[model samples]
Target: MIGRLNHVAIAVPDLDAACAQYASALGATVGAPQDEPDHGVTVVFIDLPNTKIEFLYPLGDDSPIKGFLEKNPSGGIHHICYEVDDIVAAREKLLAEGARVLGNGEPKIGAHGKPVLFLHPKDFNGCLIELEQV
Candidate 1:
């Protein structure tokens, strides 16, 4: 049902600063940053061997990450995305198995330029899960 670790989203206060830090510390080149207004955040991706890391920051106070930051101040891992070959089938199978979906049955453009959907954490052992078709 799962493919690979697509990315690990880390909520940060400053996307640029976080990207720079990752670049300097891990010698990772940051990809172009993208603003996902629909999701209320912006992101910069750093590709790795088998997975990638996404630096996300709130676009405004209404952003979900903003609330996360309010709770932890210094933000942290927001969620983990797994690449899947068939999102619709996977989603349907998950739903049939009693997984709660965070959104309606629609795939939205994700930070990685792929169609994505979020599965409720309640269905994933308290770990927020993301499914991306890439």
Candidate 2:
């Protein structure tokens, strides 16, 4: 089962501009940009009191984020991550419930260095959901 809200991920065409807006206009604390080649994204985290906002940009032409940006030129909320106590158990439960898991149905190392899995957007009311083990 899902736990606390981990972070909301937003795909942005321009990573630096997005980070600058959050840091200056919103007066938020933006973390350093990190390249997650495995995930094909360059990300920056905006720290918040309760949760975090993740800014995602395409790392290469083949990056999934690039396709997302192509569909949404202005960029938008890419996914919402929720914490899980045990990813394997959670995956099994969701699978048994008929929910579709994305990408080979296996957990991958996320931006936080935690095991993460992505669920099909249609399965979760048109919003991509990420489950991260905490």
Strongest candidate by TM-score: 2
Instruction: Spell out the clash pairs found in candidate 2.
Output: none
Residue 52 of candidate 2: its Cα lDDT? Answer: 95
Candidate 1 residue 93 C-alpha distance from true site, Å: 0.8
**Model 2 compared with the native: what TM-score?**
0.95
lDDT tens readout by residue for model 2, 1-134: 67899999999989989998999999999999999888789999999999999999999768989988999999999999999999999999999999999999989988788999999999999999999999
lDDT of 1 by residue, 14-92 (tens): 7777888888987997888888887788878888887888888888568878888788677788899998998889888
lDDT winner among the candidates?
2
Clash-forming residue pairs, model 1: none
Per-model TM against the reference: 0.86, 0.95
Displacement of residue 35 (Cα, Å) in model 2 is 1.3
